[model samples]
Target chain A: MLKSRIIPCLDVNEGRVVKGVKFQNLRDAGDPVELSFHYQDQGADELVLLDVTATRQERIAMLETIERVRQRLSIPLTVGGGIGSIEDAGRLLNAGADKVSINSAAVRNPDLIAAMSARFGAQCTVVAIDAKKQGEIFQVLTRSGTTAEAIDAVAWAARAESLGAGEILLTSFDRDGTRSGYDLPMLSAVTDACSLPVIASGGADSVAHMVEAFQHGAHAVLAASIFHDANMTVGEVKQQLTDAGIQVRNEW
Target chain B: MIQIINTGVANIRSLQAAFDRLGCTWNLTVSPEDIATASHVVLPGVGAFAAAAEAIDQLGLRTAIIDRINHRESATLCICLGMQLLCESSEESQSAKGLGIIPMAITRFGDGVKIPQLGWNEVRPLDNGPYDAGEAYFANSYRLETAPDGWGAAETDYGGTFISSIWRGRTLACQFHPELSGTWGESVLTQWIEGITC
Candidate 1:
């Protein structure tokens, strides 16, 4: 009974959550730890904190944020962004991140995926591919979707799985921030191309969008703005998903 | 105090946090002496099976772990890859050997289901097990297909039924990570910590 996971992705810049954050219940909407507690209280299956910090000095802040959040939050926490090496991944894991997502670094040196998987275990190594529709095919985009690597997203996902990635975080660049819905064709292409479990990201603004993502072969659904917009809680999303006939972990 | 054997890989910090939440005093150590004599020893591991098994052997904790698991005083608990180590061998690493305490083998899950089965799954108690039926989070590709003799088990289904947990005397080992499995997992830890397993 592997239930579909509902994850709330938070952007942690300089250790504080930033961008599109409008939590009604949170007094300090920027604090990563507090925001994590809010998500946990809402019965989120897991939390993904992307370290959107630009400077190296801000790295320590994200680590501190992870440690603080781990001290209280019991659900699994995944940290991504700015992970350029095995050391970066190790630091986040030591700081209490259950998994580390790599994008540009993985694209630059595909071997890094194998290295991370070897040292930490494949279960903790996630290869995130931000895909943008380029004519008939989806092109892999990296560096915050500023660059296209000329690699087909589906093929890259297969390569990542062969290189020992435990999971794939496939985000649609075209649909991100638009909230129109997930790029279903691109998501299904990646999931169908690889055997690893896929987490569908980007353009998830409604419960139906999430349901469609699951139906399109997503093992988990990751949303940021939908949850941060203060429109709904993770519990309500899970409840609706359950009502829609999707299996989810029941809250105790 | 529970002394956790440092496998040198697993997410020990988060495991420590779980114990702290339970109000239990614990410490981390790779010392065989500590594991051999501690009131309760925890073997927590994440990563490759061969690597972990080799680490235990190289650290000289193999014999101590076996001795502890056989102890009548509720001595040991193993988690995830820790559970695989109790078995004699695993398909994950054909050349490497497990601790060989349990008479069983580990193999990869069959196709038709996602490999390295991740996310939350139900753990159904067996033989009047300590905890009630509840779901627990899992992140494993290899699993024990059948229950070993002289042990109690709780199984989970994905591609097929696999033993998710096994307990004998005062010792327990789980394929699913109890530390990350939410409340049902916490209750599992509480039951084991208090030596309340049936």
Candidate 2:
């Protein structure tokens, strides 16, 4: 059986990791390579580095950072944020990212998904959807969740899959950074809509929440604040999941 | 020296990074001469099988790699699409013919099993290969039905048991990406390198 994955997301702004990740052993929160190695030691299945401000110059810096991080560890590295075109994804992949995640750009041009999948293969293209509950339905949001579209979250997921997207990184805008729990309803809707692997992002406060996300059909669970703030370790989370009867990687 | 063949199908920087982390020296080469002189050769590829095989043949690496594996004592490791290219043929691209180093055909996962069996899966070593029975990361939509006779070194199950790694003489191939499979992957790679150099 395939084990559930635990991925920690690092938000990079202007070449530095932002939001102040406070690990006890890490003195520099801005060092992405250092933090990534530390996370690997703590048993993170994968690492996601998002350039929050992916400016023209920042993209270059992000590539350098990815190269540095890639040299330090052997785990899968996923790079995202401001990936608007096939060129953008290519640059990241060439820089040593195992996978590239596209969100706003994919929303703007749905066909980009197919183009990327065709060029890099679907396994390398990850379509990240930021969605929020609007009225009676979950609506897709873009531009950092400030702009909303009429597209239904579930339908969009199915469409992305049909377009050759290998996986979906579904982030619930309503529950993002809330530390409450995953939006089980939205997660269930998207997972039920598509057969592709679904990675649940946002609103994870405890180990139980991760288990719930798995129970809701998430193949992986991604967290930021809880892991970044040093509130819980990846090992503790994986151990909790293992104790709950979930098969998790035991390397850590 | 370790020579990583550049097929232009995927970036080899991650593989170089893996060697760098291990404090091992390697060269990225597309030249057949460099491949001929190397003690170990790594053929790593991604994307479509047809494209990769085309690139290998276009670059004249097919003859070079086959010669090294068949004649010289150099250990050759084929990864992912590189492994598929060693088979007889694949259903992915009908017009493309594999190198036929191994007399097996690659096929897509059958119905009821998810295409692109992604994530970490257990690999059971069927022989006295370097790899132990452990979980390694895998990302592929197709697989071989069974191991190629005595070459079956490791077998993994997704929809059913399939050959994940094969070892025949000095040649080794794996369907999973060891460079991206964390510590377990790194150790397996290190062992392969040692087996060749020592």
Candidate 3:
């Protein structure tokens, strides 16, 4: 019985939590530790802390923020942004992160996944693929969804798993912030191609959307706008899923 | 200094980090000689039990470390898959043998609780006197069902009241990741460090 996880993602910049409407016009949400504890209390399965700022300035700040958040909760924390090397993943793991999500760096250096997974375990590594559907195929995007890459999402996900990525956090750039629902076709394509767990991200407006993502083969569903805007708390979303007969962790 | 036996498993870095955070000095040893001279041994692992157990045998430190645990009152802390190794065998890998220090076997959670029981779980001390209950971190698919003679600790719910933590003679174990368990984990580690006399 693998429960579908409900994650609340927080975009961190310069030690502060920021929430953007659609990856633009960011507004300060709160402190990293405070927001993390709040999300955990509200029944978030895990917290994703994305260092939204440019990599150069926020490296140390991001690490410190992760450490502070780690001190506050015992839940799994996934740190992304500027993690370009095994040393970066090691440093983050040392600072108390459960998993590290690699985006542009992973796509650029596919061997990093294998090397890190060899040093650390595959379960400790996750590849976050930002994808946007074009024509019939969804393509992987880099630079936090700003750059449209020509790589096929499904193929890249399979490659990632082969390279020792334990899980795939697939985000739908087209559906991001639109809240219409997740790009189920894209998620299903990736999950079918790879045996690893797939966490569906983006375009989850209602509780039903989250359920649909799981039903469509997502191991877990992630929604940032819904959770951040207070439209639907993680608890409420889990409750809705449970009522809909979808398996979700009952702890919260 | 305590020696953390690395049997080709995960969580060693985090364990080392925890020790560092506690200002405790320790060494990560995969050698038989280092384990033999070590005052304390911490076994930290994750993933499949069979693979890890095979790794322990392959590394050839199994007998040496176990000898250290049995011969002296050395502090031995096994976390997650390492804790599972204390049992006799696991259903996850029935062919894979365990260290058999506690006369227990690993069983699946079944249709009851979820597999890979991910995230945080509370430790409800088996009420066998001396132990206290606290929240602990866990991430595993199989559980250790100890025989009555060796059941050290148990968590409250999930899968027919299994042993979440066990204490048999000098050997101590917890299915949870103490390094990831926060303050309660630190307390558990402290107790292990202080109570176990090497």
Q: Please identify which of the two predictions, 2 or 3, would achieve the higher TM-score against the true structure.
A: 2
Q: Is the docking of candidate 2 incorrect, acceptable, medium or high quality?
A: medium
Off by over 4 Å in 1: none
lDDT of model 3 at position A207: 89
State which candidate has the highest TM-score: 1
In model 1, the fraction of reference contacts reproduced equals: 0.78
**lDDT (Cα, 0-100) at B193 in candidate 1:** 91
lDDT of 2 by residue, A95-134 (tens): 9998999998998899999999888898888999999998
Candidate with more favorable, higher DockQ: 1 or 2: 1
Worst 10 residues of 1 chain A by lDDT: A18-27
Clashing residue pairs in candidate 2 are none
TM-score of B-chain for each predicted structure, in order: 0.97, 0.94, 0.90
lDDT of 1 by residue, B6-55 (tens): 87867788789899999999998989889878878899989999999888
RMSD of candidate 2 to the truth, in angstroms, is: 1.6
Backbone clash count, each prediction separately: 0, 0, 0
Model 3 lDDT tens row, A165-198: 8788999998898979999899889888887778
lDDT tens digits, residue span A71-190, model 1:
887888899998999999999999999999999999999999999999999899999999999988999999999998889999999999999999999999999999999999998888
lDDT of 2 by residue, B1-198 (tens): 788998887767788999888888888889999888788899998888888888988998888887876663578888888888888799999889888877888999887655677788888888888667777888899888787765747888777788888877667788888888888898889878877422
